[model samples]
Target: HGSNIEGMLEAVELADGNPLHLAHINAYCRGTVLPEAEETELALKALAANPNISCESYLSPLNGTSAEIIDGLPGSMVTRRCLKTGGFTEDEAGMEAALLSGWAQVNYPQGQEMTLLTGEAARDYWRGQQTLVSVSFAVNPVGPRVRLATAKKADGSFAVDAVSTDGGGIPRNVLLAAGLALVDLGGLSLQELVAKISYQPARLLGLANKGSLTAGRDADITIVDRLQHSAFATIIGGQVCYMDGKVLGRGGRIITTAAGADYVRSQGLEPLVVDLADSSLLQKAQKR
Candidate 1:
């Protein structure tokens, strides 16, 4: 995450103005490989200058990676990365031993039980698993997290476009409560809050009818308890899906990219076209 931001920015620059959506950039600036504060400043500067790039950050302190993806050997860059910040051993045997010794947590099946594997058990699991296996790591810190979340233009609008959970089924979803918490701390205003969680993300995705409450827009919405900092109710397409911790509905449709564009065009729905190379989020900073 540390110097990865530098490399990612370089790639964006090399893309010759192609649109790029960077994910969980706060994790990259937290200084796993480079100094945190320095990298954060550099990242902010790069983002301010690049209108083509938009990114999101999650509020959680933990970031995750797949154990199956690591090379799991001495002298491998991934192995070195794990060893440097994640307390992994230098070699494959060491990694196995570390896994057995509770050095790494394995994401198991069933309820996604996080079991600490060790010794032969860990080695065996690694050897046997054909599909992907994931591991959690605490690679983020508060300094970069806060800085990325609050980055702003001269006009005080947020520079980091959105706050995403980046969590689907892995249970790391913290966008709702965490965003509300940020509002309570004066880190962001309510309108800005809406921008970060709803408007901005919708804009990023080119979902013209999803982010706002205006007529003809989708009724997908969530009501949050200001006092509790939690979701009070959930609505989707003018239907009450959930309220008071009870799910009132279940069923959703998945739209593939090809199908999505086709449906929109067939319906004569001209959604807003987002500029991938120059997002509205960085307008002020880019102007300055």
Candidate 2:
């Protein structure tokens, strides 16, 4: 599971005769080598076609972009350095450098050119420089050319705009609080990513009774509120438990004894009966 594609393929072949609950294929994008887009698409299609296989792609935007070194001393100096090295024009290099340095106002769709440096080439570019800038740069002809500004709106809310970042959509859900941080940074919304985590794992595990909210089945529910950006409650097996917000207790008849009391009496602790004085335990038990 941790090795190369050949090793993973070998493992999958070994597991073919058995049941595989989950299998995560590591598709590292090393400057678009090996698992290229075409190869990855084919692999995914093939995997999906297999009845026993469920595949997940761990993609990162950092792998597709060209790397560039920018000087921080001055915009002009950085521009000249980039141009002299035959990597980027003065304006392009200046804009890129400024963007990297927290200045996202250089301009839109700047024609910044940089050698697609990797391996030894990338290392050599940073060897002598005191501070070298490197970013995974992707160039696509379809979308807008300018980088979105990471600024707040007039109402103090974050401006909604798309900007490029690293990592696949998978880790944005299962990685704990870091996932929320990634979402806040415009990587992906928690709700959108959590849905993938909820269903994809179930499908991979081949669990027909779970992974969804439907009738005539165990109540496996994950209640979330879009406004709060968190799971407010969860229900399982017809039991519900509040997680984030408080729910007031309602009036109900207390069950002093039940038919199951005989089973406890058989254990010889005590044949006792108690009122339902506390409801929290009942609430939590219902959730399970």
Candidate 3:
């Protein structure tokens, strides 16, 4: 029988002389706690010392264990259709949903409560509001593997505090203030956490020139104030491109390149020209 760590321990006892395989052991507390790891090591050593029992543990990268949703997958067509009917422009619906879904899966834990409302509820809550939604899927072969959660204000406004977790197996780096110095400190200081842990993981991944206080690198840095989730300033490529949370630079520079313009124009064999007659159209055209 398939089981988590505790269940596996019981199975070991019940199997008597039979062989057993510990599958996806990391899903349980055994992988997280020091004592559990020690216990597992001891148990394996004991099993190896015995002549009758054979045991083995399989380990896989946590990311690799989770399910993957491929582009143009059959199941995704439902979401695609829903978004189109929901008044989302094709590109906006597809790209935005993909991006949000990815972010949600990475941060939230599995088995959390999620509600997908429709008709009046969806209209009352989500209409004309900027929001972020997140989901968590379990990597374990155990029961009830996927879960979702959402946070919103009383007036149907989406709250910034809406974050999800995959059980407690959230990445250590993403916790930022809560993981490094807070938790016991009543609450986490976002500013301090950003200054510390958030960038280190990227550096460790051989993005050497990406995250640093040094010069001549990418100059990609974010500055934030206390108690605010938004960054005060963001610099890239030795230029202060974003300040006061607003992006500057446009027209074939940081925001776009001349090559990008050529490609877009080439797509339809049309010369892209801006018409200032309509304010809305002018703004959209400028972005392109």
Winning model by lDDT: 1
* Model 2 clashing residue pairs (backbone): 65-137, 65-138, 109-145, 239-286, 239-287
Question: What tens-digit string does per-residue lDDT give for candidate 1 at 138-205?
Answer: 56777887778878966666768888766545545667777788888898888888888888877666
| TM-score versus the correct structure, for each prediction | 0.77, 0.33, 0.30
Candidate rank order under TM-score: 1, 2, 3
Per-residue lDDT of model 2, residues 1-288, tens digit only: 333344445554776534332232333211123434433333333344333443343222222212233443333332343333334445544434434443221111124323333344334443434223443332111111111112223553222111222233212222324334456767556654454455433433334455567786557776766555566776655666545665433322222255546776666544334433222223223344
* Candidate 3 lDDT: 0.35
Residue-by-residue lDDT tens digits, candidate 3, 1-288: 233345555655775644333332334423322344454544443344332332212121122112123443313332333334334433433424533443213233235433333333332333233322222222222111110001123553211111222233434212322233242343334443333233432322224455456666566776654355345776766678778856774433211223455666656443323222222222323344
lDDT-wise, the better of 1 and 3 is 1
What lDDT is obtained when candidate 1 is compared to the true structure?
0.67
TM-score of 3: 0.30
Clashing pairs in 1: 51-277, 51-278, 52-277, 99-117, 100-118, 100-119
Pitting candidate 1 against candidate 3, the one with the higher TM-score is: 1
